[model samples]
Structure formats: C-alpha cells, structure tokens
Target: MSEIPPDLRYGDSHEWVRAEDDGTVVVGISDHAQGELGDMVFIELPEPGMNYNQGEACAVIESVKAASDIYAPLSGEIVQANGELEDSPELVNSDPYGEGWLFRMIPSDPAQIDGLMNAEAYAGQLARILHEGGPINT
Candidate 1:
C-alpha cells in the first residue's frame, strides 16, 4: 500500500496538495502515483508565475514505465517549482511529498483544497481501484 499523508489533501487524479502558512500550496503526485509510474526519469514543471485552472495539466513526469501529466489541484499562479528534480527525477520515487514536490502556487481560493479527498478517503479510493483491477494512472 502507498503512504497517504494525513496532512495533505488529495485530488482524484492522484495529486496531493499541502496548503502552506504563506497561503500558497505545495503540489505533487501522490506516492501511489509515483509507484504506478515507476522510477521517474524526467520532470517538466511549469515556470513560476504561470497560471492554471483547477484540473489543468500543469506539469509532466516521465518514468521508466510511462509519462504522466500532473494536474493542478486548484486554480492559481505558480510561485515556485522544485528545480532539483530536473537533475534527479528519482526524488519523486524517494521522497514524493518532500523534495519531490513539483510546484508551489498561490491558490485563487485556498478553501478549494478543503473539497479534496482526505487521506482516509484517498486510501479507500485507491483500494477500490486496485480491487476493481483498474490500472493506476497519473
């Protein structure tokens, strides 16, 4: 089973969001997502200051197994991106929620994150998908 961090809000598409005290949110694919994708080989993240709508594809992560799009968890402008991933994409596989974080964005509405699945809900969703034999996509 993948680790679902209790502090982060999860998107149905398998992204996780952590609201920062500065009113920005750190975004990354869930551990479940990275596991499904396999060892990450490349990552293409949006430049800081780019705007996106909720659910829009904002970045791309390529793994040895497949390439997957990373969606925006909430509408906002990107404030920062993790530059280290460009040199060591394996960080996604090693520490998905920490050094592997893709970007930080100032949400148009921070409350939007509250609508996402909690850790428990996301875990159940993952379990259901696995039980149904559905392949875990990005």
Candidate 2:
C-alpha cells in the first residue's frame, strides 16, 4: 500500500494540498501519483506570481514512463515553486509529501479548499482506482 499522509487534502486528480501557517497552501503530487509516474526526470512549475483557477494545470512532471499535469486544487496565485526540483527531480520519488512539494499558493478564496477530498475520501478513491485496474486520468 502507498503511504498517504493523514494531514493533507487530496484531489481526485492525485494532487495533494497542505495548508501552511502563513496563509499559503503547499501543493504536491501524491505518493500514489509518483509511483504511477515512475522515475521522475523533470518538472515544469508555474511562475511564482501566476494566478490559476481551481483545477487548472499549474505544472507538468515528466517521468520515464509518461508526462502528467499537476493541477491546482483551488483557485490561487502561486507564491513560490520548488526550484530544487530542477536539479533533483527525483525528490518527487524520494519524498513526495515533504521536500518534493511542488508549489505554494495563496488561495483567492480559502473556502475553496473545503471542496477538496479529505484523506479518507482520497484513500477510498485510490482503492477504487486499484480495483478498476490502475490510474485513471480525470
């Protein structure tokens, strides 16, 4: 079973969001997602000042197997991106929920986050996907 951290919220698209103390939310591709993507080779992250709507494609991560888009879980203006990814894209595979975090954003409306799935709900989603046989693009 993949490790799903209890504190983060997840999107059906396999993105995870963690709220920070400074009103910014940290975003990343979940462990399940990294596993599906295989060995990550590169990432194209959004600019720090870019504004994105909920569900928008904010970045792209390419692995040995495929390229996948990373979506915004909520509408927000990007505040920062993990520049370390340029040099160490493998961090996504090594520490997906921590040092592998992709970006941080200041949400346009904090309440938008409430619509995202909690950890349990995401776990159920993952189970359903496994039962159905592998990742389903949404």
Candidate 3:
C-alpha cells in the first residue's frame, strides 16, 4: 500500500506539493509514484529561478524501470533544488516525502494550489487506476 500523507496536495501526474511557512512550496513525487517507478537511478532537478506553468514537465527521474518526467504542481519559479538527489537518487525510493523532495518554488498564484487534489481524492484516483488498469487522465 502507498503512504498518502493527509496534508499534501497532489497533481494528476503524481507530483505532491507541500506548502512551507516561508511562502515556498516543496515538490516531490508521491510515494505511490516512486513505488511504481521502481528504484531511482538518476534525478534531474530543475535549476533555481526556472519558472514553469502548472503541469509542465520540470524535472526528470530515471528509475530501473524507466525515465519519467516530474511535472510542476503549480505555476511557479523554482527557488531551491535538492542538491542531494544528484548524488543519491535512491533517496527517492527510500524517503519520497522527506529527504527525497526535488525542489521548492514560489507560486505564481498561491490560490492555484487549492485547485490540486487532496490526499483522499488522489488516493481514490490511485485506487481507480489500479483496480481498473486504465491510465490516469493526466
């Protein structure tokens, strides 16, 4: 079973968002996503100051199974990237919600975060795709 933390907002592409008190939001792939991808071998984090619109592919994560794009959960400028992943991509598989975070961003429209799916909704979608064996509508 995947660990779906109750407090985070999720994107259709399996990216998770955690808003920080500092006005920046941290971004990472959901635990379910990491599990599906298998062991991560390489991760390419977006550079700080780079901007992306919601749903845009901003980073790359290569696992033993395949290489996947990590999309932006909200329109924002990346403020900080996790430098540790460059050296330890396996952290993605080990601690996806914590030390495995990819980047932090300053949202272009903070209100847009509210438009993302909550954990319950994401869990529902996850179960639907698993049980139905159909692709998510991302």
Q: Using lDDT as the measure, which candidate wins?
A: 1
Cα shift from native, residue 10, model 3 (Å): 0.5
Q: Please write out the lDDT profile of model 3 over residues 20-113, one tens digit for every residue.
A: 9989999999898998889999989999989999889899999998888888899999999999999999998899999999999999999999
**Residue by residue across 1-138, what tens digits does model 2's lDDT show?**
998988889987989999989999999988988988889999999999999999888899999998888888999899999999999999999999999999999999999878889899999999999998965562
List of clashing residue pairs for candidate 3: none
The TM-scores of all predictions, comma-separated, are 0.97, 0.97, 0.96
- Each model's lDDT comes to 0.92, 0.91, 0.91
Checking candidate 2 for backbone clashes, the offending pairs are none
- Sorted by lDDT (best first), the order is 1, 3, 2
Candidate 1 whole-model C-alpha lDDT, 0 to 1: 0.92
- State candidate 3's TM-score: 0.96
| The best candidate in terms of TM-score | 1
Q: How many clashes show up in model 3?
A: 0
